[model samples]
Target chain A: MNYRDPQLCELLAGQYVLGTLSARARRRFEGLLPGRPDLRRQVAAWEHRLPEVLGQAPAEEPPAAVWNSLNRRLFAEAATTPASAPRGLFERLGFWRGWAFTSSLLASVFALALLLGRETEIPGYVTTLASMKTRTPMWVVSASPEMDRLYVRALLPMDVPHENGCLLWIKPEGSDQYYLLGSIPEHDGADKMLKIDRKMRPMLKGELYVTVEPVAKGMPEKPAVAPSFAGNWVPIKI
Target chain B: MSSTPEVLGDLLARCALADRAAFEKLYRLSSPQLFGIVLRIVRDRDIAADVLQETYVKIWHRAGDFRADLATPITWMGSIARNQAIDTLRRAEHRITQADDVDEMYDLADDSEGPQDAAARERDAAALHRCLEELQGAQRTAVRLAWFRGMTHEELAEHLDTPLGTVKSWLRRGLLRLKTCLEGA
Candidate 1:
């Protein structure tokens, strides 16, 4: 198709923005959008012109959860930790390795408790981590009630290089601060347990986020890259 | 709608810097109108909420790419919401099976105010309403149905009880007139 033809582009762009183009045609137009600035301009023109139609719709307030969710996602880290600090205990490999061994043992006990339906005293919380973009669950993150330890199990294999690893972050409730909990091993499908610092335990009641960063340099105080997966650490009900 | 172009542009610039407060301000200033637009197209409250969420996420990430010279922030964001709604509608199994279904597709622009009052409120909106009024009645209906219903040419022809070729002609002529009128405005 002569997508560059001004007449055709205008026609298609109008229909595209108006939502009248067929699904197949719409995809074709969108595929053309990235490379063609003129096509994009045409689409924008149509968009600017159409809102009078939209302005006619009666406005309704969105439910409060929308703001709460957005607030939790964007500001949780700013409330607890200075954005540039690197003092988190999770940045140390030796501490992480020791905790990994202990966390595995704890996870086994926790699993056994679940299987036997027996009561346990380790107040714990668990959440399924999912991609922000796709909303597909990728991992499960669990924390002991005392908020001193975390267990992360991979539900899907991730692609992390030997020199690179995944880091977990916690954002305490009612605060904008984000704390670096520590790094997970580079193994794609392996489960790793982490020890949360005693000082940071009180801040673990908020949300959990995981990001892939260079392990050789140590985990940064803040995620240098976008989080790979994230979820809230809801308390476990007996 | 109370936010001026300058306010929205400033908020968008701050959002590009990962300013959480600015993002919240932008959402509060713009979301009700954008949500209304999405609800109009998707016609499902839950789906509209999801689409609105995704739309804001995109707005947050793409804030740096926004150019004030190209379009107003609301226009750019509204386009994102509308396109997402159209995609969601297309993916679902529900399809308009009868001509009567098209009538329920959109609520007409509230006509409580006369044209003069509307024009005085917002120049751009007034200009658009005026230009749209210039088209022949059939052309206007065809264009509105095509837009508000997201109908294909065949679907539009079926809904309007007109020949496929005639519907195409009306839409083509209507769009050309709209482009000329909007640009001239």
Candidate 2:
């Protein structure tokens, strides 16, 4: 579509404001709007003309809880979130500083066995999977000493559409390769345990990743979508 | 309505500076209409409340991006509420199932307009209403359903029991006519 064409621009802008454009087309239009003042003006004109349609709907006061929740979200909680766990991953990383904060309280706890001489029954490795940008923790990945079983627990709300499951991946420290660990269950927020073969266990040592993939695809050779969350796994000395 | 655009714009500007008092004032002034807009589409109070909360959070963070010359404060805020509701609707396993009950849920015939509507009716809204009346009956219905229900072309076709192509044409022609009429008004 030639957005520079005045007729097309007006029609697209009208459809965009009317909410009749397809999701992909709407996103494309939005991406184009920032650079095109003519398109921006068209969208603004459409928005200006449409609010009355909104006014036709009679107004009803929301419950007091709505305002309370907003206040808590914008003030009470945001103030305390950074103090407790460093609210955003971008701040910690510094390179990607302006990304939106998606998750919260990303605490990576390492419980190493006190005595290396004794055979420890606890999990051999554990790491919290978090977004690199938001630093908000989403899932906890833990592996048994024998590397036979992996446990994943969702800590935040995840939108997994039907027929799609979260697939876990691992990239060793110096290697560029991403090995598929397996698919974790969707957002039941329940602890999901996946049986892992001996071969895939050692590959889980470095960075952990969780990506949304089609269930039919099984484990792809590489991630089909960008990893939703990522974290580094560090060994704790006893 | 007691809060004029200038006041709301000032409050939004203050909110951009992270003033809590300004945020609260903006919420108190703007949320009712925003909530109404969201609730009309989502049709569930809990979901509407959640979307409204998210909308206000965005407003708080992105308040600085708002340009008063481009859109009214309410329109800018209301667009966020509507977009959030649309996102929720798209992401839900079962899309909001209240298409049949939108009129009842919104009380479309309730003539007790709020002060904001009265104030709006004095200006652009009045022109819009007059222009909307000029659309053909089907065109009017098509535009209203798309606006109020957040129905995409496919969903609108399903809801209206009309063919997809026909619905698309209705929307395109209706919106084009609306644009021309609104511009003239």
Candidate 3:
């Protein structure tokens, strides 16, 4: 393949940008891009030109939760693989799998609770811890007295600064385990109701710990920030 | 033109450095565009969000690879967004063909303006949008196939069942027209 032919390059570039290029052809082009500047130029030209055609696409705001989850994943990656970046679905799955073990544990609890008469208390006044300096809240922490459910609300006000999405966690005393409640919305002043089974709910000792992890759309997870909010369980005085 | 491309590009660059600020900025600037494009292709908000996150992860790692020569920041970002979306569509077993799909794909642009961009994009999008309008049907098809589907000539040929020469010609003429149109705009 003559990588230098302008017309051939443009033709190939157009197709590549259009995504009509075969998988094999794309690999070949990617192989050429690093070694051949001219090829890269052609590809770039197509990229610059084609975006207008895509203009008719609707402008949509992704729920902030996506960004929040992405940050958690990226930060988590930074903690474990700071030097070597995680890539592709398998790597992502590995990240999710590590968290899944905890989810599975929750699932097991759900099964047990359903079978027995064990009742779980819903958390009240779920609040995210604010940043020490800016006092900006970073995660969404919620409480639900309803067993098997989490009532989530973005604690940060509409104007308060924070990431778009967040990671939910519950730390019950004596368990040494952190319960993952997936991702939730952050920016908009809307409350999200999350369902938690026996496996997902932290069997709290009245006082429970909650944390949020920040995420973005493209990057890996950042570090899990320290617990932003804490609640105390007041024993019922008989 | 909206400020999306440049903002996204800037954020992408910052994200490469693991800058959360950049990541947040990028999300604010481009998530709507990414979400819009992906939602159009996938038609599911939840799945679109998943794709959006994955796309950003790719962007974080690959943002450094972005070249001023290959595409404008938005185009480059758009390419990533579109490709990830189509990949999800394929993975979900949506068997829609290319020709029909392009028609649906191009409808994502908003003629009704909302956000604003830098003066350069204003000039660039005007020119690019016009050039896109001037393209012949075949030329447009070739461009869309390459850009949106990430298809190569051979796959395009196979999918369209057209002669290789015809495909090449359409793509060439289409690109030239686009260049001229963009430059003039």
Q: Which has the greatest lDDT? A: 2
Interface RMSD value for candidate 1, one decimal? Answer: 9.8
Per-residue lDDT over B8-84 for candidate 3, one digit per residue giving the tens place of the 0 to 100 score? 55455444434555566677777787787677667677888998998888777665456544466666777788778
Q: Model 1 clash pairs?
A: A77-A176, A77-A177, A77-A178, A78-A176, A78-A177, A79-A176, A79-A177, A80-A177, A81-A177, A123-A145
Q: How accurate is candidate 3 locally (lDDT)?
A: 0.58
The DockQ-derived docking category for candidate 2 is: incorrect
What CAPRI class is candidate 3?
acceptable
For the second chain of model 3, what is the TM-score against the true structure's chain B? 0.64
Report the poorest 10 consecutive residues by lDDT, candidate 2 chain B: B109-118
**What lDDT is reached at residue A160 by model 2?**
80
Give the top-scoring candidate (TM-score). 2
TM-score of each: 0.55, 0.59, 0.53
Determine the iRMS, in angstroms, of model 3.
Answer: 8.7
| Candidate 1: stretches off by over 4 Å | A53-56, A70-238, B94-127
lDDT of 2 by residue, B21-104 (tens): 668888888888888888877888989888889898878866755777788788788787887888788778336554465445
Q: How many residue pairs clash in each candidate at the backbone level?
A: 10, 2, 56
Question: Residue A1 CA error for candidate 3 (Å)?
Answer: 1.8
